[model samples]
Target: MLTEVKERLHSLGISVSSEPSNVDEVIIKFSIEKVTNHIKNQTNLSEIPTGLKEIAIDMVVGEYLFSKKSMGLLNIDSLDFGLIEKQVQDGDTNVTFAVEASSTPEAQFNAFIQYLRHDEVDFIRYRVLIW
Candidate 1:
Protein backbone atom coordinates (compact mmCIF):
# COMPACT_ATOMS: atom_id res chain seq x y z
CA MET A 1 0.00 0.00 0.00
CA LEU A 2 2.88 2.35 0.81
CA THR A 3 4.45 1.63 -2.55
CA GLU A 4 1.14 2.16 -4.29
CA VAL A 5 0.66 5.44 -2.45
CA LYS A 6 4.16 6.55 -3.39
CA GLU A 7 3.53 5.64 -7.01
CA ARG A 8 0.24 7.53 -6.93
CA LEU A 9 1.94 10.59 -5.54
CA HIS A 10 4.62 10.42 -8.18
CA SER A 11 1.99 10.06 -10.88
CA LEU A 12 0.31 13.17 -9.50
CA GLY A 13 3.57 15.14 -9.95
CA ILE A 14 4.52 14.99 -6.27
CA SER A 15 8.12 13.88 -5.93
CA VAL A 16 8.45 11.72 -2.80
CA SER A 17 12.20 11.36 -2.76
CA SER A 18 13.99 9.74 0.18
CA GLU A 19 16.77 12.29 0.22
CA PRO A 20 16.81 15.16 2.75
CA SER A 21 14.48 13.24 5.09
CA ASN A 22 12.01 10.39 5.38
CA VAL A 23 9.08 12.76 6.04
CA ASP A 24 7.39 11.64 2.86
CA GLU A 25 7.26 8.07 4.06
CA VAL A 26 5.90 9.20 7.39
CA ILE A 27 3.19 11.19 5.67
CA ILE A 28 2.23 8.26 3.50
CA LYS A 29 2.01 5.94 6.49
CA PHE A 30 -0.02 8.46 8.42
CA SER A 31 -2.42 8.85 5.52
CA ILE A 32 -2.85 5.12 5.22
CA GLU A 33 -3.58 4.80 8.92
CA LYS A 34 -6.03 7.66 8.77
CA VAL A 35 -7.91 6.20 5.83
CA THR A 36 -7.92 2.77 7.37
CA ASN A 37 -9.30 4.10 10.61
CA HIS A 38 -11.95 6.03 8.79
CA ILE A 39 -13.04 2.95 6.90
CA LYS A 40 -13.13 0.80 10.00
CA ASN A 41 -15.07 3.35 11.95
CA GLN A 42 -17.57 4.03 9.22
CA THR A 43 -18.11 0.44 8.26
CA ASN A 44 -17.96 -1.01 11.78
CA LEU A 45 -15.47 -3.54 10.54
CA SER A 46 -12.22 -4.78 12.03
CA GLU A 47 -10.49 -4.67 8.68
CA ILE A 48 -10.93 -3.03 5.33
CA PRO A 49 -13.00 -4.98 2.85
CA THR A 50 -11.45 -6.06 -0.41
CA GLY A 51 -13.96 -4.05 -2.37
CA LEU A 52 -12.77 -0.86 -0.72
CA LYS A 53 -9.06 -1.29 -1.21
CA GLU A 54 -8.96 1.00 -4.19
CA ILE A 55 -11.11 3.56 -2.44
CA ALA A 56 -8.83 3.41 0.55
CA ILE A 57 -5.86 4.04 -1.69
CA ASP A 58 -7.59 7.05 -3.21
CA MET A 59 -8.49 8.41 0.21
CA VAL A 60 -4.91 7.97 1.35
CA VAL A 61 -3.73 9.88 -1.66
CA GLY A 62 -6.19 12.64 -0.89
CA GLU A 63 -5.03 12.72 2.70
CA TYR A 64 -1.39 12.88 1.65
CA LEU A 65 -2.11 15.69 -0.77
CA PHE A 66 -4.07 17.50 1.92
CA SER A 67 -1.16 17.23 4.31
CA LYS A 68 1.28 18.48 1.71
CA LYS A 69 -1.00 21.39 0.85
CA SER A 70 -1.42 22.25 4.52
CA MET A 71 2.36 22.31 4.96
CA GLY A 72 2.78 24.43 1.83
CA LEU A 73 4.81 21.65 0.25
CA LEU A 74 2.42 20.94 -2.61
CA ASN A 75 3.43 22.78 -5.73
CA ILE A 76 0.31 23.71 -7.67
CA ASP A 77 1.56 24.39 -11.15
CA SER A 78 -1.92 25.31 -12.28
CA LEU A 79 -1.88 28.29 -9.97
CA ASP A 80 -0.78 31.18 -12.14
CA PHE A 81 -1.41 34.86 -11.51
CA GLY A 82 -0.84 35.74 -15.13
CA LEU A 83 -3.59 33.43 -16.30
CA ILE A 84 -6.15 35.17 -14.14
CA GLU A 85 -8.00 37.87 -15.99
CA LYS A 86 -7.65 40.75 -13.64
CA GLN A 87 -8.59 43.41 -16.10
CA VAL A 88 -10.56 43.67 -19.29
CA GLN A 89 -10.61 46.73 -21.52
CA ASP A 90 -13.18 47.49 -24.19
CA GLY A 91 -12.07 50.90 -25.43
CA ASP A 92 -12.70 52.17 -21.90
CA THR A 93 -9.50 51.11 -20.11
CA ASN A 94 -11.61 49.39 -17.48
CA VAL A 95 -9.45 47.61 -14.97
CA THR A 96 -11.08 45.22 -12.56
CA PHE A 97 -9.36 42.54 -10.54
CA ALA A 98 -12.15 40.29 -9.40
CA VAL A 99 -11.12 37.52 -7.09
CA GLU A 100 -13.38 34.51 -7.48
CA ALA A 101 -13.67 32.04 -4.64
CA SER A 102 -13.22 29.13 -7.03
CA SER A 103 -9.91 30.55 -8.29
CA THR A 104 -8.15 31.25 -5.00
CA PRO A 105 -5.80 28.78 -3.39
CA GLU A 106 -7.63 28.94 -0.10
CA ALA A 107 -10.88 28.15 -1.86
CA GLN A 108 -9.32 25.24 -3.69
CA PHE A 109 -7.80 23.91 -0.49
CA ASN A 110 -11.05 24.22 1.38
CA ALA A 111 -12.90 22.45 -1.39
CA PHE A 112 -10.39 19.62 -1.38
CA ILE A 113 -10.54 19.28 2.38
CA GLN A 114 -14.31 19.15 2.20
CA TYR A 115 -14.09 16.45 -0.43
CA LEU A 116 -11.82 14.30 1.71
CA ARG A 117 -14.00 14.78 4.76
CA HIS A 118 -17.34 14.03 3.14
CA ASP A 119 -16.34 11.14 0.89
CA GLU A 120 -17.85 8.45 3.11
CA VAL A 121 -20.54 7.89 0.50
CA ASP A 122 -18.11 5.72 -1.38
CA PHE A 123 -17.78 3.37 1.57
CA ILE A 124 -21.49 3.04 2.26
CA ARG A 125 -21.87 -0.03 0.17
CA TYR A 126 -19.30 -1.89 2.24
CA ARG A 127 -20.69 -0.84 5.58
CA VAL A 128 -21.46 -3.52 8.18
CA LEU A 129 -24.18 -2.90 10.69
CA ILE A 130 -23.11 -4.07 14.11
CA TRP A 131 -26.01 -3.74 16.47
Candidate 2:
Protein backbone atom coordinates (compact mmCIF):
# COMPACT_ATOMS: atom_id res chain seq x y z
CA MET A 1 0.00 0.00 0.00
CA LEU A 2 2.84 2.36 0.83
CA THR A 3 4.43 1.47 -2.45
CA GLU A 4 1.25 2.34 -4.29
CA VAL A 5 0.90 5.66 -2.47
CA LYS A 6 4.51 6.45 -3.28
CA GLU A 7 3.93 5.53 -6.87
CA ARG A 8 0.85 7.68 -7.20
CA LEU A 9 2.57 10.62 -5.56
CA HIS A 10 5.52 10.13 -7.83
CA SER A 11 3.29 10.05 -10.86
CA LEU A 12 1.95 13.41 -9.80
CA GLY A 13 5.46 14.80 -9.06
CA ILE A 14 4.89 14.89 -5.31
CA SER A 15 7.45 13.59 -2.89
CA VAL A 16 7.21 12.47 0.72
CA SER A 17 8.61 9.93 3.11
CA SER A 18 6.14 7.62 4.79
CA GLU A 19 6.67 5.65 7.96
CA PRO A 20 4.09 3.37 9.46
CA SER A 21 3.67 3.07 13.18
CA ASN A 22 1.28 0.28 14.18
CA VAL A 23 -1.25 -0.89 11.65
CA ASP A 24 -3.48 2.17 11.71
CA GLU A 25 -1.24 5.10 10.83
CA VAL A 26 1.22 6.28 8.23
CA ILE A 27 3.26 9.35 9.01
CA ILE A 28 4.13 11.36 5.92
CA LYS A 29 7.03 13.77 6.07
CA PHE A 30 7.61 16.44 3.49
CA SER A 31 7.06 20.12 3.03
CA ILE A 32 3.29 20.40 3.28
CA GLU A 33 3.69 23.98 2.17
CA LYS A 34 5.14 22.80 -1.09
CA VAL A 35 2.35 20.31 -1.60
CA THR A 36 -0.31 22.86 -0.83
CA ASN A 37 1.38 25.31 -3.14
CA HIS A 38 1.38 22.73 -5.84
CA ILE A 39 -2.23 21.99 -5.18
CA LYS A 40 -3.09 25.64 -5.44
CA ASN A 41 -1.08 26.07 -8.60
CA GLN A 42 -2.10 22.83 -10.19
CA THR A 43 -5.13 20.68 -9.46
CA ASN A 44 -8.82 21.23 -8.85
CA LEU A 45 -10.96 19.69 -6.12
CA SER A 46 -13.67 18.89 -8.62
CA GLU A 47 -11.20 16.59 -10.29
CA ILE A 48 -11.16 14.27 -7.32
CA PRO A 49 -13.28 11.16 -7.55
CA THR A 50 -16.76 11.26 -6.07
CA GLY A 51 -16.30 8.90 -3.09
CA LEU A 52 -12.98 10.27 -1.87
CA LYS A 53 -14.40 13.05 0.32
CA GLU A 54 -14.70 11.07 3.55
CA ILE A 55 -11.31 9.47 3.24
CA ALA A 56 -9.75 12.80 2.38
CA ILE A 57 -11.42 14.32 5.41
CA ASP A 58 -10.07 11.57 7.59
CA MET A 59 -6.59 12.29 6.29
CA VAL A 60 -6.96 15.94 7.21
CA VAL A 61 -8.52 15.22 10.61
CA GLY A 62 -5.76 12.74 11.26
CA GLU A 63 -3.32 15.44 10.12
CA TYR A 64 -1.75 13.61 7.20
CA LEU A 65 -1.70 10.46 9.26
CA PHE A 66 -3.68 7.95 7.24
CA SER A 67 -5.89 5.58 9.19
CA LYS A 68 -5.73 2.09 7.83
CA LYS A 69 -8.73 0.89 9.78
CA SER A 70 -11.06 3.74 8.82
CA MET A 71 -9.93 3.41 5.24
CA GLY A 72 -10.51 -0.34 5.24
CA LEU A 73 -14.07 0.21 6.24
CA LEU A 74 -14.66 2.87 3.59
CA ASN A 75 -13.24 1.42 0.41
CA ILE A 76 -15.02 -0.54 -2.25
CA ASP A 77 -14.60 -4.29 -2.58
CA SER A 78 -15.14 -6.22 -5.77
CA LEU A 79 -16.76 -3.19 -7.42
CA ASP A 80 -18.97 -2.67 -4.41
CA PHE A 81 -18.92 0.31 -2.10
CA GLY A 82 -19.02 -2.23 0.70
CA LEU A 83 -20.45 -1.88 4.18
CA ILE A 84 -19.49 0.82 6.65
CA GLU A 85 -21.22 2.99 9.24
CA LYS A 86 -20.61 6.10 11.30
CA GLN A 87 -21.66 6.61 14.91
CA VAL A 88 -22.91 10.03 15.92
CA GLN A 89 -23.08 11.09 19.52
CA ASP A 90 -26.20 12.69 21.00
CA GLY A 91 -26.59 16.43 20.31
CA ASP A 92 -23.86 16.26 17.69
CA THR A 93 -23.99 15.14 14.11
CA ASN A 94 -20.24 14.64 14.03
CA VAL A 95 -19.52 10.98 13.62
CA THR A 96 -16.86 8.63 14.81
CA PHE A 97 -16.20 6.01 12.22
CA ALA A 98 -14.24 2.89 13.16
CA VAL A 99 -13.20 -0.45 11.77
CA GLU A 100 -10.70 -3.26 11.96
CA ALA A 101 -8.37 -4.17 9.09
CA SER A 102 -10.22 -5.84 6.29
CA SER A 103 -9.27 -7.29 2.89
CA THR A 104 -9.44 -4.03 0.90
CA PRO A 105 -6.32 -2.29 2.13
CA GLU A 106 -4.96 -1.26 -1.25
CA ALA A 107 -8.21 0.13 -2.54
CA GLN A 108 -8.75 2.12 0.60
CA PHE A 109 -5.23 3.49 0.57
CA ASN A 110 -5.56 4.49 -3.07
CA ALA A 111 -8.83 6.27 -2.45
CA PHE A 112 -7.42 8.06 0.56
CA ILE A 113 -4.60 9.53 -1.48
CA GLN A 114 -6.58 10.18 -4.62
CA TYR A 115 -7.32 13.78 -3.75
CA LEU A 116 -4.46 14.34 -1.36
CA ARG A 117 -2.73 16.80 -3.67
CA HIS A 118 -5.84 18.64 -4.74
CA ASP A 119 -6.58 21.31 -2.15
CA GLU A 120 -7.47 22.06 1.47
CA VAL A 121 -11.19 22.10 0.69
CA ASP A 122 -11.49 18.47 1.65
CA PHE A 123 -10.32 19.28 5.15
CA ILE A 124 -12.33 22.46 5.41
CA ARG A 125 -15.46 20.72 4.18
CA TYR A 126 -15.03 18.06 6.83
CA ARG A 127 -14.57 20.57 9.64
CA VAL A 128 -17.56 22.58 8.50
CA LEU A 129 -19.74 19.49 8.21
CA ILE A 130 -18.68 18.16 11.57
CA TRP A 131 -19.32 21.36 13.42
Candidate 3:
Protein backbone atom coordinates (compact mmCIF):
# COMPACT_ATOMS: atom_id res chain seq x y z
CA MET A 1 0.00 0.00 0.00
CA LEU A 2 2.71 2.42 0.94
CA THR A 3 4.72 1.53 -2.17
CA GLU A 4 1.72 2.18 -4.41
CA VAL A 5 1.13 5.54 -2.74
CA LYS A 6 4.76 6.54 -3.26
CA GLU A 7 4.66 5.51 -6.90
CA ARG A 8 1.49 7.50 -7.47
CA LEU A 9 2.97 10.51 -5.75
CA HIS A 10 6.04 10.15 -7.99
CA SER A 11 3.89 10.02 -11.10
CA LEU A 12 2.31 13.25 -9.91
CA GLY A 13 5.78 14.84 -9.58
CA ILE A 14 6.12 14.19 -5.85
CA SER A 15 9.32 12.39 -4.88
CA VAL A 16 9.09 9.78 -2.14
CA SER A 17 11.76 8.05 -0.12
CA SER A 18 11.95 4.34 0.57
CA GLU A 19 9.80 3.00 3.37
CA PRO A 20 11.63 3.01 6.64
CA SER A 21 12.12 -0.41 8.21
CA ASN A 22 10.48 0.91 11.35
CA VAL A 23 6.73 1.31 10.82
CA ASP A 24 6.14 2.67 14.30
CA GLU A 25 8.55 5.50 13.60
CA VAL A 26 8.80 6.20 9.89
CA ILE A 27 9.36 9.18 7.67
CA ILE A 28 7.54 9.84 4.44
CA LYS A 29 8.64 12.59 2.11
CA PHE A 30 6.66 14.53 -0.49
CA SER A 31 6.27 17.96 -2.08
CA ILE A 32 3.46 20.36 -1.20
CA GLU A 33 2.75 21.38 -4.74
CA LYS A 34 2.70 17.76 -5.90
CA VAL A 35 0.20 16.72 -3.28
CA THR A 36 -1.99 19.75 -3.80
CA ASN A 37 -1.95 19.26 -7.54
CA HIS A 38 -2.80 15.62 -7.08
CA ILE A 39 -5.80 16.55 -4.95
CA LYS A 40 -6.92 19.18 -7.42
CA ASN A 41 -6.46 16.80 -10.33
CA GLN A 42 -8.70 14.28 -8.62
CA THR A 43 -11.44 16.88 -8.86
CA ASN A 44 -12.64 19.06 -11.75
CA LEU A 45 -11.10 22.48 -12.17
CA SER A 46 -11.28 25.39 -14.56
CA GLU A 47 -7.77 25.02 -15.96
CA ILE A 48 -5.45 22.17 -16.78
CA PRO A 49 -3.52 23.22 -13.65
CA THR A 50 0.16 23.78 -14.46
CA GLY A 51 0.95 25.92 -11.46
CA LEU A 52 0.03 26.70 -7.83
CA LYS A 53 -2.76 24.23 -7.21
CA GLU A 54 -5.22 26.11 -5.02
CA ILE A 55 -5.82 29.31 -3.11
CA ALA A 56 -6.41 27.48 0.18
CA ILE A 57 -2.85 26.17 0.00
CA ASP A 58 -1.75 29.38 1.65
CA MET A 59 -3.68 28.92 4.89
CA VAL A 60 -1.95 25.93 6.54
CA VAL A 61 1.50 26.77 5.25
CA GLY A 62 3.98 26.81 8.06
CA GLU A 63 5.13 30.32 8.90
CA TYR A 64 8.83 30.65 8.28
CA LEU A 65 10.06 33.60 6.31
CA PHE A 66 13.49 32.12 5.67
CA SER A 67 12.38 28.51 5.40
CA LYS A 68 9.09 29.69 3.86
CA LYS A 69 6.51 27.07 4.66
CA SER A 70 4.54 26.52 1.50
CA MET A 71 1.25 25.22 2.91
CA GLY A 72 0.04 23.53 -0.26
CA LEU A 73 3.40 21.89 -0.62
CA LEU A 74 3.31 18.42 0.94
CA ASN A 75 6.17 17.56 3.27
CA ILE A 76 7.10 14.49 5.27
CA ASP A 77 5.22 14.59 8.54
CA SER A 78 3.02 12.45 10.78
CA LEU A 79 -0.24 11.60 9.02
CA ASP A 80 -3.13 13.82 10.07
CA PHE A 81 -6.48 13.42 8.29
CA GLY A 82 -8.71 16.19 9.70
CA LEU A 83 -7.51 18.86 7.33
CA ILE A 84 -10.48 19.11 5.02
CA GLU A 85 -10.24 20.32 1.44
CA LYS A 86 -12.33 23.34 2.46
CA GLN A 87 -13.05 23.46 -1.24
CA VAL A 88 -13.39 20.91 -4.03
CA GLN A 89 -14.92 21.21 -7.47
CA ASP A 90 -16.23 17.68 -7.84
CA GLY A 91 -17.41 17.47 -4.27
CA ASP A 92 -19.56 20.01 -2.47
CA THR A 93 -16.50 21.05 -0.49
CA ASN A 94 -18.92 22.89 1.69
CA VAL A 95 -17.94 21.95 5.19
CA THR A 96 -16.61 24.26 7.82
CA PHE A 97 -15.23 22.88 11.10
CA ALA A 98 -14.46 24.58 14.35
CA VAL A 99 -12.66 23.90 17.58
CA GLU A 100 -15.03 21.76 19.55
CA ALA A 101 -14.81 19.90 22.83
CA SER A 102 -17.28 17.17 22.03
CA SER A 103 -15.99 13.67 21.38
CA THR A 104 -17.50 13.51 17.89
CA PRO A 105 -16.06 16.87 16.90
CA GLU A 106 -12.71 15.93 18.34
CA ALA A 107 -12.88 12.67 16.47
CA GLN A 108 -13.53 14.56 13.24
CA PHE A 109 -10.66 16.91 13.86
CA ASN A 110 -8.41 13.95 14.63
CA ALA A 111 -9.37 12.32 11.35
CA PHE A 112 -8.74 15.52 9.44
CA ILE A 113 -5.38 15.88 11.04
CA GLN A 114 -4.55 12.29 10.20
CA TYR A 115 -5.42 12.78 6.54
CA LEU A 116 -3.57 16.06 6.28
CA ARG A 117 -0.52 14.53 7.87
CA HIS A 118 -0.86 11.17 6.17
CA ASP A 119 2.31 9.94 4.47
CA GLU A 120 0.30 7.90 2.00
CA VAL A 121 -3.32 8.26 0.90
CA ASP A 122 -5.05 5.35 -0.83
CA PHE A 123 -7.23 7.42 -3.16
CA ILE A 124 -4.21 9.12 -4.72
CA ARG A 125 -2.48 5.90 -5.71
CA TYR A 126 -3.65 5.81 -9.32
CA ARG A 127 -1.32 6.54 -12.23
CA VAL A 128 -2.06 9.38 -14.62
CA LEU A 129 -1.08 10.01 -18.25
CA ILE A 130 -0.18 13.36 -19.67
CA TRP A 131 -0.57 13.98 -23.37
Candidate 4:
Protein backbone atom coordinates (compact mmCIF):
# COMPACT_ATOMS: atom_id res chain seq x y z
CA MET A 1 0.00 0.00 0.00
CA LEU A 2 2.85 2.34 0.77
CA THR A 3 4.35 1.64 -2.62
CA GLU A 4 1.02 2.26 -4.33
CA VAL A 5 0.58 5.55 -2.49
CA LYS A 6 4.08 6.63 -3.46
CA GLU A 7 3.43 5.65 -7.05
CA ARG A 8 0.15 7.55 -7.02
CA LEU A 9 1.91 10.59 -5.61
CA HIS A 10 4.56 10.36 -8.28
CA SER A 11 1.95 10.00 -11.00
CA LEU A 12 0.34 13.17 -9.72
CA GLY A 13 3.70 14.98 -10.14
CA ILE A 14 4.21 15.32 -6.42
CA SER A 15 7.81 14.08 -6.76
CA VAL A 16 8.27 11.53 -4.05
CA SER A 17 11.95 10.66 -4.43
CA SER A 18 13.21 7.15 -5.10
CA GLU A 19 14.58 6.95 -1.59
CA PRO A 20 12.34 8.72 0.87
CA SER A 21 13.60 9.79 4.27
CA ASN A 22 12.42 8.18 7.48
CA VAL A 23 10.11 11.09 8.18
CA ASP A 24 8.64 10.83 4.72
CA GLU A 25 8.03 7.13 5.16
CA VAL A 26 6.38 7.79 8.51
CA ILE A 27 4.10 10.42 7.02
CA ILE A 28 3.15 8.14 4.16
CA LYS A 29 2.43 5.26 6.49
CA PHE A 30 0.40 7.50 8.77
CA SER A 31 -1.65 8.78 5.85
CA ILE A 32 -2.29 5.26 4.59
CA GLU A 33 -3.41 3.99 7.97
CA LYS A 34 -5.62 7.03 8.52
CA VAL A 35 -7.37 6.67 5.18
CA THR A 36 -7.63 2.88 5.35
CA ASN A 37 -9.13 3.02 8.84
CA HIS A 38 -11.69 5.58 7.74
CA ILE A 39 -12.77 3.40 4.85
CA LYS A 40 -12.93 0.29 6.97
CA ASN A 41 -15.05 2.06 9.56
CA GLN A 42 -17.34 3.49 6.91
CA THR A 43 -17.99 0.06 5.43
CA ASN A 44 -18.16 -1.69 8.80
CA LEU A 45 -15.50 -4.08 7.64
CA SER A 46 -12.16 -5.06 9.13
CA GLU A 47 -10.43 -4.76 5.80
CA ILE A 48 -10.65 -2.59 2.72
CA PRO A 49 -12.48 -4.23 -0.15
CA THR A 50 -10.67 -4.70 -3.47
CA GLY A 51 -13.24 -2.52 -5.26
CA LEU A 52 -12.42 0.50 -3.09
CA LYS A 53 -8.65 0.18 -3.30
CA GLU A 54 -8.27 2.92 -5.88
CA ILE A 55 -10.46 5.30 -3.96
CA ALA A 56 -8.50 4.49 -0.81
CA ILE A 57 -5.26 5.23 -2.62
CA ASP A 58 -6.56 8.59 -3.80
CA MET A 59 -7.79 9.43 -0.34
CA VAL A 60 -4.39 8.54 1.10
CA VAL A 61 -2.77 10.89 -1.34
CA GLY A 62 -5.11 13.64 -0.25
CA GLU A 63 -4.41 12.85 3.38
CA TYR A 64 -0.67 13.01 2.75
CA LEU A 65 -1.03 16.37 1.01
CA PHE A 66 -3.12 17.72 3.84
CA SER A 67 -0.54 16.63 6.38
CA LYS A 68 2.27 18.32 4.48
CA LYS A 69 0.27 21.51 3.98
CA SER A 70 -0.66 21.69 7.65
CA MET A 71 3.00 21.38 8.59
CA GLY A 72 3.96 24.19 6.17
CA LEU A 73 6.10 21.70 4.24
CA LEU A 74 4.19 21.75 0.97
CA ASN A 75 3.73 24.48 -1.60
CA ILE A 76 0.31 24.26 -3.19
CA ASP A 77 1.73 25.38 -6.51
CA SER A 78 3.92 22.29 -6.58
CA LEU A 79 0.91 20.00 -6.73
CA ASP A 80 -0.84 19.02 -9.95
CA PHE A 81 -4.19 18.10 -8.48
CA GLY A 82 -6.02 20.19 -11.14
CA LEU A 83 -7.58 22.17 -8.32
CA ILE A 84 -4.88 24.79 -8.43
CA GLU A 85 -5.78 27.18 -11.19
CA LYS A 86 -9.02 28.26 -12.71
CA GLN A 87 -7.42 30.40 -15.42
CA VAL A 88 -4.09 31.79 -16.53
CA GLN A 89 -3.40 34.70 -18.85
CA ASP A 90 0.18 34.73 -20.11
CA GLY A 91 -0.08 38.01 -21.99
CA ASP A 92 -0.43 40.18 -18.88
CA THR A 93 0.68 37.45 -16.50
CA ASN A 94 -2.71 37.27 -14.86
CA VAL A 95 -3.31 34.10 -12.91
CA THR A 96 -6.40 33.02 -11.05
CA PHE A 97 -6.30 30.10 -8.71
CA ALA A 98 -9.17 28.21 -7.16
CA VAL A 99 -10.99 30.13 -4.41
CA GLU A 100 -9.95 27.61 -1.81
CA ALA A 101 -6.30 28.45 -2.34
CA SER A 102 -6.87 32.00 -1.21
CA SER A 103 -8.73 31.01 1.89
CA THR A 104 -7.36 30.15 5.32
CA PRO A 105 -5.65 26.82 5.84
CA GLU A 106 -8.51 25.64 8.01
CA ALA A 107 -10.95 26.48 5.26
CA GLN A 108 -8.83 24.74 2.68
CA PHE A 109 -8.56 21.66 4.89
CA ASN A 110 -12.31 21.78 5.42
CA ALA A 111 -12.82 21.78 1.68
CA PHE A 112 -10.44 18.83 1.43
CA ILE A 113 -12.35 17.01 4.15
CA GLN A 114 -15.56 17.66 2.22
CA TYR A 115 -13.97 16.10 -0.85
CA LEU A 116 -12.87 13.03 1.13
CA ARG A 117 -16.40 12.70 2.52
CA HIS A 118 -17.77 12.89 -1.00
CA ASP A 119 -15.65 9.87 -1.86
CA GLU A 120 -17.07 8.03 1.12
CA VAL A 121 -20.41 7.77 -0.64
CA ASP A 122 -18.88 4.99 -2.70
CA PHE A 123 -18.67 2.88 0.43
CA ILE A 124 -22.45 2.71 0.71
CA ARG A 125 -22.68 -0.45 -1.36
CA TYR A 126 -20.18 -2.19 0.88
CA ARG A 127 -21.72 -0.91 4.08
CA VAL A 128 -22.91 -3.53 6.56
CA LEU A 129 -26.15 -2.87 8.32
CA ILE A 130 -26.43 -4.62 11.64
CA TRP A 131 -29.63 -4.13 13.58
In terms of lDDT, the poorest run of 10 residues in model 3 is: 59-68
TM-score: model 3 vs. ground truth? 0.21
Give TM per candidate: 0.68, 0.24, 0.21, 0.69
Where does candidate 4 stray beyond 4 Å? Answer: 18-21, 80-118
Query: CA lDDT, every prediction?
Result: 0.76, 0.41, 0.37, 0.76
Model 3, range 1-131, lDDT digits (tens) per residue? 23444444454344544647632113232234444555457533433243332222321121111022233333434333455333345475555444454435335534544444434233343434455
- Which candidate has the top score in TM-score? 4
Report residue 52 deviation for candidate 1 (angstroms): 1.1
lDDT of 2 by residue, 1-131 (tens): 34544554455344444436532234433323333333333334433344453443333333343333344532223333344343557785576654545536455545545544345554443232211
Looking at model 3, residue 35 earns an lDDT score of 47
Better of 3 and 4 by lDDT: 4
Off by over 4 Å in 1: 19-21, 78-118
Cα lDDT, model 3, residue 129: 49
Per-candidate alpha-carbon RMSD to the true structure: 6.9, 13.7, 14.4, 5.8
